[model samples]
Target: MKPGIFKPLKLKPFRSLFGAQLFSDLGNWLDFIALQVIVAYHWGLDETAIASVIIVLGLPWVIIGPFASVFVDRLPKKAVMIVCLLLRIVFVGGLFYAPNLYILLLFVFLKGTVSALYDPARQSAIRMVVPDSMLPEAVTLSQLSVNTMKIAAPALGGGIIAVLGPKSPFLFEAAGFVVSIIFLLFLPSLTSFEESDNRMAETSTVKTSFWKEFSEGIKHIFHAPLLRISIILSSAAFFIIFLYDGLFIFIAKQIGFNEGNFGLLISAVGAGSVAGSLLLGQWTGWNRKPVHLMSSSAILSGTFIVAVGLGGLGFLNFPPLVWIIGACLLGLLGAGESVPYGYVLQSETPKQMMGRVSAAAMSLQTFSMLIAPAAGALLAKQLGASFVMIGAGLATTLLGSTMLMIIWKKSGSFQPIRGKQLDG
Candidate 1:
């Protein structure tokens, strides 16, 4: 973060929202690890089942979220967020009592649905209290909590699962939600904040049908060149990004690394992610270029992944610790993925359409993910994980570098006039 990053923290509503996100995201990562344990180790399920969990996580957002996000715009952002958090508490608790894989899938799906709505509303809420000039800093700070938790929660969740049992992590997840709710309770009405901004309909209402709102949002993104291009590049980046993501265990094994130590590799990725995010936030050159941040991220991340694959193939004589370092670099690049897209979505979209537009972008990313895991796993099985990583990495680099060139090819078209909010 930059020296003035703390400026956003001066606002009490933003402070409350930040605190809530910190706890909420921490518990999310903890639940992620705990579920892996319960599904793969405790239940002794097959690889298909484990992958199914990943797919289920994205299913709601991809399939139902874009349309459902219409309601997010129609409701009070704070109320929607609070309700979603409360529902998530119940959904996380449901994991403990789930009797079978099918039941477990249902609970995960429900939780994802709530998150789909909660996330966009949260984005809208941040835009509510934080000034546009400070929006980038606020978002970076919010995501810092997520990346920070990514490093700590995996280790902590693993320890809790081993010591207290697989179900113990859920208790912590619930605690996180409770704390978030406590903080959210302090978020004052932002009616004045909305008024000062001069964006119309600062109040939530239902003048149009759900289908109309949904179509308007989709049209808005498709109509705006920068938003359209940035979103497509971000989504496509993730599609390639995930090609080797779920196959890490196999990648580790093929590279002669122990599978049990996979958590360390993940933690390394988290640390790299935190570092990368902070570095970019402070990097004046790429300060608010969403496309550049994302494009450069894809190219660099691919190169690192390719190196890891080569190491796995005995083409490079790197030790396991070095491999972990490589994974960290990849994780650092992962930080670039969301932050840039988020900045664009918040800064470019109308305040009224923030919920729908963010959801649309997220849904596109999720749509790519819905198939990437299965594809990656199958590819790893057939061609060996190292070869799969190499292929995926090459593709990712090409996509990143190509998209950056195409967008910048046009000069004034990509630059935005900052004074007015995008009605689109």
Candidate 2:
């Protein structure tokens, strides 16, 4: 039987790591909102300037992720995580006094660089801290933490900004990092986990050059059929889905939603994500066929996206609440898709190479984010916003179905990844 959502908290190390991750992720959302408020409301900057800030924040993940993952693999993950948090605390704290946009951008870049290093290390550490069987539960809880913050942070940040001013959220963000660091200190050392895993020792002593090691990580990913296909499908889904990121506001306006109602529309996704993650956490059977679950959920999410797009275009003149219901359904399927795929990545990868593999996966997602908005904007300009959203939905549905067919043909059945199933 599946354990409850709180089952993983029984492990002290996981508890500590999860707590640290919660605070850190909450701080990230807080800082994101604060930055947007500072740029748009406080400084009266245009959308172009705001976009530049976001691009700078994400650039390191695209450019430095693979290279940074090399060091993540070599270093002590706990120490690396601590250092990343400390650096973020400093950089975001500086945002409080960043007299101008130039200084703010510099701090954002530095924080992004630190985050690029932090992410792979943290992902690697999760495998070390928890038993393999609990990986899906651990990932689910971690995602729940993220989605919880997604639902709460904007409102919290907005409240703080309203009461205390734009710079106040930065102070809270810095404090969150401090709390995260304190929680991280309670976790067992990464060295202890590494010493226990002889495979990790064997891999670490391979004595390859830095570039060779990095190249091996890339080659390993592509040569593994499951990893390659899963990563590509997941990345493509994200690329298509995010094409509506910037156009959501326009869609909301077309649907006659006020700013307050628009917040509800966005929050509906977070609410559904929380619900889905919790539901998945309590259900143990999902591990049996993660690929199938992922593909199926992607298709469902795409259908919901199409429904919302069509509604916005006046094809289905439902009430605004109905549209919000569709958004919730989209969010629910999104969680269903992401959680299983994350479990696949964690459970399938060797512990020794987890950092590099996770980094490669993250880099692909980051690249998608980098391009999706621009593509969405250009396409919306030419084809109309609603049509662009419809196109994204169609692309997602097609991609998911195609990936499912490929998987079915290769295995004759949707078999779980057992011993050496993905060996090249």
Candidate 3:
């Protein structure tokens, strides 16, 4: 039997944690818009300067994520989360008084550093709170919350900025951290076997070096074939899909869409993401192999992306409504890949190494973000935005096909770890 969408919410700790994360996610999007306005409009920065700001914000995750996860594993996950949130609130609040672009960039980098700790700790904490059987639903619902915010927060931030001021969104974001901290305070303490058993073993026996512990995480990921394949495919998919973010404006213009209608494209993706997550949340078990499911979704998503490109090139000749529908279909298929991919990571990873594994996975995604925009922009300049989109779609389709073939040849079936097998 399938679980209800609300099934994970029935767990008290998960319920509170989910609520807190929802507020934080909303504040993040709000702050994202506000910062863009401050950097581009208020400060009169050019495109290069704005891109530099984004690079600074993302650099910490790529550089510091693995080391940060070591602390997450050593400390109590809840304690790390609360402290990280408090630090984030301070850095976000500092954004209000940032008198110059450099100062603002400094604060954004600090906030990103803190978030590095917060994210892995939160993922590890979720494992502690819910039974392994419920993780897929929990992850799906969590993704749903994020997508819902993605759909709404931009509009909310715009309204707040218009009514209040440019700095209002940062203030709002700071207040959200306070609320998130309050919720964290009500949660119980959580400790993994590594934290408890390993700590005692380290104290009484020989202590493991920090480098050794960190290296273990890297080794674990690469050594596990299934985990390794998923990470690579996920990173490739992210790189391909995010190319659109850099080229969307040009693509929209080619399709005869004004700036206002461009927003509709983003909204369509978010709406489809919500629907896809909701569907996955209720459909208890996915009886198919994880790799097959993931690759198939990628294929479908890439197909839609190709369709969107063809529409822009007048090959498809899609009307505005049809174009929007294609974008929604792209998003829907994207969720089909992403949600299951997340489940594969969480379920396959040992509880003790959850922080490290999650951090590593996140770093890969961040690295893709750090490069995708620039690559897309350069390609769009030479080949045109329509061709860039088509190229990305074709690349994604090729990647999925290759992975599907490899997985089928190496392992006829890949079963996700559940219950007791998960702990192994």
Q: Give all candidates' CA lDDT scores.
A: 0.82, 0.83, 0.82
Task: Go through the candidates in order and give the clash count of each.
Answer: 0, 0, 0
lDDT of 3 by residue, 247-276 (tens): 887878888789878889889989998988
Candidate 2: list runs displaced more than 4 Å. 1-3, 197-208, 412-418, 421-424
Model 2 vs. true fold: TM: 0.95
Q: Relative to the unseen true structure, what is the C-alpha lDDT of residue 411 in candidate 2, on a scale of 0 to 100? A: 70
- For candidate 2, write residues 295-371 as lDDT tens digits: 88887777877876887798868788888888888888888888887887877776767788889888888899888
Worst 10 residues of 3 by lDDT: 197-206
Model 1 error, position 413 (Å): 1.9
lDDT order of candidates, best first? 2, 1, 3
State in Å the error of residue 251, model 2: 0.8
Positional deviation of residue 394's Cα in model 3 after best superposition, in angstroms: 0.6
For model 2, state the Cα shift of residue 39 in Å: 0.8
